[model samples]
Structures are given as C-alpha cells and as structure tokens.
Target: MRLTPRIVPLLLLAAALLGAAPAAPHPVEAQAPQASWSWPLEPRPAVVHPFDPPERPWLSGHRGVDLAASAGATVRAPAPGTVVFVGWVVDRPVVTIDHGDGLRSSFEPVDSPLALGVEVEKETPLGTLEPAEVGHCAPAACLHWGVRRGDEYVDPLQFVEDRRPSVLLPWAGPP
Candidate 1:
C-alpha cells in the first residue's frame, strides 16, 4: 500500500507508542503491568460514588471514586510519589501527588498541610478530610479520590484491589 503523507505520520505514531510500551503477552498484561498501588483511605472507606469516565473530556461524568468518610478523617497516599500540587482545585482543597510512570492520584476537600515538591510513601499521612457543604455524600461527609494516567482518568478501584475480576489472571482459551 502506498502511504500518504497523513498516513505516514499516523503509522510512525503507532510504532512509537508500541515501542514505548512494555511488551506484554496480551493486552491486559500491558494495561495492568503491576498492582502495587495501595488505598488512599484506611479501614476501607465505603465507596459512595464509583468512577464513570466520560467518553469525551467535555462530557459529564464522575471522574473519580468517592469514599464515605467523616470530617477530619485521615487521608493517606496510595503510592510513593511527590506532591505536585497542594491547594484548592475549585471550591475545595485538593492534594495531587505524582506517582511517576505518568500516574497521579488526587484527593479533594483535604486539609493537607504538605506543600508541593514533597516526597511521600504509601500510607504516608496526607492530611484530614474537610467536610464539604454541598458534597456528593451530602449530610454525611465523604472524600473524593481520583487517579489519572497523564490526562486520562482511570478507575481508582484498580489501585486498591486486584482488578483481574475472575479466578484466573488470564482468560480461558482453547489450546
């Protein structure tokens, strides 16, 4: 096939992505290379809202998971990372940690005293959760935890739990 000018760029981009990604036997292996991440909140906080990544960036969707917590509830880091941003994201205080590998976790309405550029390990004390006046779990307080790979929103549950779903790691297939 004769490659057009536009097609050549597309092909080069695809090849670059494949070369950059870890060689996996299957797509799932490449998708989830490791499951070393930990939970952000201890005592396994109840999930008030689940992740619902939108089809588009402008579309409406729940980008993260909401954990049922109380005011002043302890919030911890889910992985070893550097504090990239620690301040208000909108109306509520937020703490964003960069876990390297293009992955980052964010907690909203948190009272984190840590400043940006601080290094933290898994289960490191981030701060306490500040109750929101008009929150997802209103009347009862909760914390909104989010994870992102670059600019793409990823399911936060995958970090805390093994997302293999089935008993076997790989899908059954005929020999």
Candidate 2:
C-alpha cells in the first residue's frame, strides 16, 4: 500500500485511464426565474419573429420576438412592474418596465400613455400598438417584445410559457 516502485506503474496507469474517460455533461439551467407572467396581447398574437441572439454582444441579431398585432390594439403588461421608461427609441415608441430582481421588459412601437415611475400590475393596459414603418414586419404593425436580465437579453416567451425543450421518453408499447 506504500509508495513502492512496483506499485507506481499501476497507480499511474489507473490515473491515466480515469482522466481519459469523458466527463459527465453539465445540466442546463434556466436563464430566468419562473413566474406566472402572461402574454401582453390578448388572444395571444402570433409570433411573427423569434429570438435569435447574436453570438457576440455587439453583433447584429434579432434580440427579441415580434408578435403580429394590429395598429391601435391595446398592449398590456405581462407582469407586475414599474414603468421605467416611455419614449421613442430610434424611430419608434417604447415602454420599458422594471420587474425587479434585475429583470426588465421592453415593448417597442407602443404608444404608451403610462408615465415613468408608474406601477403596473399583470394585464394592466400599458398602451396601444402604434403603427410603424421601421419594424421588421413593416406596413403591418407588430409588437416587438424584449426582456433583459441585467445586461443580457433573454427570451420573453420564457416568462409567459414553459421554455423547456420537449423530450421524447422511451416508448412503452402497452401503456
């Protein structure tokens, strides 16, 4: 059991074999906290565009989802939060809500009457969808919804629905 010369080669071989084995895959963690958040649009508008984040921070990519909505349709808050911003970003109007815990939601092209510092509850009417020609789906108005955790943008759909990928289980023939 001591460090004898004859036992050294066997110990080295065992160490090499253990190191060569593949490591167990790490579990994927949910980026955002689970909440009972709802869709901002009633009847649940269609997702015209989906989240496609850029590989790098400064790269060009679709950072949020675009929902098909009509011009002048009422847009509501998906969860309880305080209005942190209400103004025009670039060529379209925007309303941003701070939901605490470093989570913030922003909706663009929304003609919000709500002022900054105003508290909003789930489903509260934040504003109406404003017609914009600069949106990805131009000519037809749509809502651009985005969420952020700190500085990192996250999938807004994760707030409204379970974002877990569907897994196929082993088939049991007679179940």
Candidate 3:
C-alpha cells in the first residue's frame, strides 16, 4: 500500500475514532461508586462462589464473594482509604476501610493492628487470618472480604485492576 499525505490523515482519523469509542461498562460498574478498589489477595484467586443463593424464605441473596486462602494468611486493604471500623466482633477482629466516594471494603476475622480513623494506603497490611482462634470462621483461614457503595454491597474484584496498592495483611503475597 502506498501512503499518500491526504490518505494518511484520513487513516489516522479513523484510528482515533475507533480508539475513542467508549469502553463497555464493567459488570459491577453500575453498582459500584466512583472510587476504585480491588481484592487484597495476591495472584487474584478465583471466588469459590461469587454469590450465595437466598437460603431463607424471606431473605435476599449473598452479598459478597469468598477468596480461598490458608488460615493465618494476610489480608490487605483493597484501596486507599481510612479505617472506619476496627474492633472485635464477637472476639473476631473486623476491619472496614472507607475508600471515599462512597466506596468501602470490609474484612471479618482480621487481626488488625491499625486502629479506627487510621489512614491507610492501598494494599497496606490490615491483619492476618487466625482461623483457629476466630470461632466465626475457622479450620481453613481466609478473609471474608466485602465491598460496599453507600449501603449496597458490590463485588470487589471488578473494580480495581492489576496489583493496586491496598491495606495488607502480614501474610499476603504479591499480587
């Protein structure tokens, strides 16, 4: 093909137009807020089951996904935010990070060293998974992580891409 001056601009314009087309919205984008976040687990493990069917006759469906990890594994923050809640829920330390713009991440059965109101970077260490100690979730330790926008829960994996920084657990490996 011989490239002429006139044709070159036209080709470039066509390429630009194609590239400018809006990307398709991610599955969770509609439900998620403007802020971005991600899973704290490294290597992006697959969810055993993303959604749990409603078990009760008058109840709703499962709100979050479960990541597979060994007990005492580290759990990191999925995004940059503030530690909104860090305390023992029935003796199992739970940590909640507020990633502003209405986005938030929550992890149960955490061994968090950060206190409430602490500002954390993305992938910062949140705590470790002590399954044997935490009665609510034991045997095989894993972080029961959840993402919330306002009050509604959304899937965390869909928001952040690649290895973004976040609150980290001591045991978490590189993503």
Candidate 4:
C-alpha cells in the first residue's frame, strides 16, 4: 500500500492499537500523563495477590492485585475521576474508574450502584467488595484491583501509600 497522508495516520494508529495489549508496549506510554492516585481499599488491605507482568505479550500472568477484603467491605475510588464502566467483564461484576491521562482502575467482584459517567473523588465510596465462591481467591472473598495505563498493566500499590486512620497517629495540641 502506498504511504499516503491518510494511510500514514491510519498505519500509525494500527500500530498503537496493537501495542496496547496490556501485556505489550508502546511509545505513548511514557508520554501519557498520570493523575494523583491512591488505593482503592482502605488501610491498605492485605495483598492476597500481587501483579505479575508477563514476559511476552501472549503469556499468562496476573494482571492485577488482589487485596484481602471482607464480603461487604466498602471499596472506594483511588482517585478523582468518572465511572467509565460498571458491569460484568467475563464472569465477575467489575467496576472501572477512569482517572484520565489514560489511567484507569478496575475492581471486580464488587457491588456498586453508581452509573456510568458518575463523578467521584479520591476515596469516594465507589462500591462494596462482594464475596465470591469463584475467582482468584476461591472460597475466600477478596477485591481484585487492577490499574492500567492504556493497555499496559501497572502496579496499583506503587502509586499509593498507607494513609488509613488505623495507621496514622493522632496528636494533641502542644501545651
């Protein structure tokens, strides 16, 4: 095919689309800006599972982190953004919050009432972690939280620090 003006742009777009495989790589990754992020679970819940990126784009690996959460624990937004999705992705009821700058967070096996495009702030009550008999944590309920920059899977915890009330020390005014 001749490299025409229209064709050139389309070709580049095709390359980018293929590069964004969550497991693949793209040049736009380093350029895409990121928002101020936080943790979806309060008190920095126990990491039942950690993100394990695949060596190859087609290899199998954990795409997200699983945090230890009760059946009905509240799951909040890690950053201020809009709800882009709230539905089933394969077998689990997932809630996805878009933090803009090509960054988004996905939490699955959750119970939420928020609709699409709902504006939420950091630590906003986005949903409640629901117990499931089938998932990464079978027989035990946990929240599967995943962060992504475009199609590239990124570590959610790396951007957040423990800031829960349980971990902070209260101080009285100096006399």
User: Which number leads on lDDT?
Assistant: 2
In candidate 1, which residue ranges exceed 4 Å CA deviation?
1-34, 167-175
Summarize candidate 4's per-residue lDDT along 39-87 as a digit string, tens digits: 6877778999988989886899888889998888999998898999999
What TM-score would every model get versus the actual structure? 0.75, 0.78, 0.62, 0.70
Which runs in model 3 stand beyond 4 Å of their true positions? 1-36, 52-60, 132-138, 161-175
**Cα lDDT for residue 162, candidate 1:** 72
What is the lDDT of every predicted structure here? 0.87, 0.90, 0.73, 0.83
RMSD of each: 10.5, 5.1, 13.4, 16.9
> What's the ranking of the predictions by lDDT, best on top?
2, 1, 4, 3
How many angstroms is residue 170 displaced in model 1 relative to the true structure, after the best TM-score fit? 13
Residue-level lDDT of model 1, residues 1-175, one tens digit each, is 9989999999999999989997655534435534677777778888899999899999999999999888888999999999999988768899999999999999988999998899999999999999778668777789999999999999988877777655335655688
Q: Between 1 and 4, whose lDDT is larger?
A: 1
Better of 2 and 3 by lDDT: 2
Order of candidate numbers by TM-score, starting with the best: 2, 1, 4, 3
Best by TM-score: 2
TM-score of model 4 (CA atoms): 0.70
Query: Per-residue lDDT for 3-113 in model 3, tens only?
Result: 999999999999999999988644332233434655687767656556453556358776666677776677888878999998877767789999899988888777788
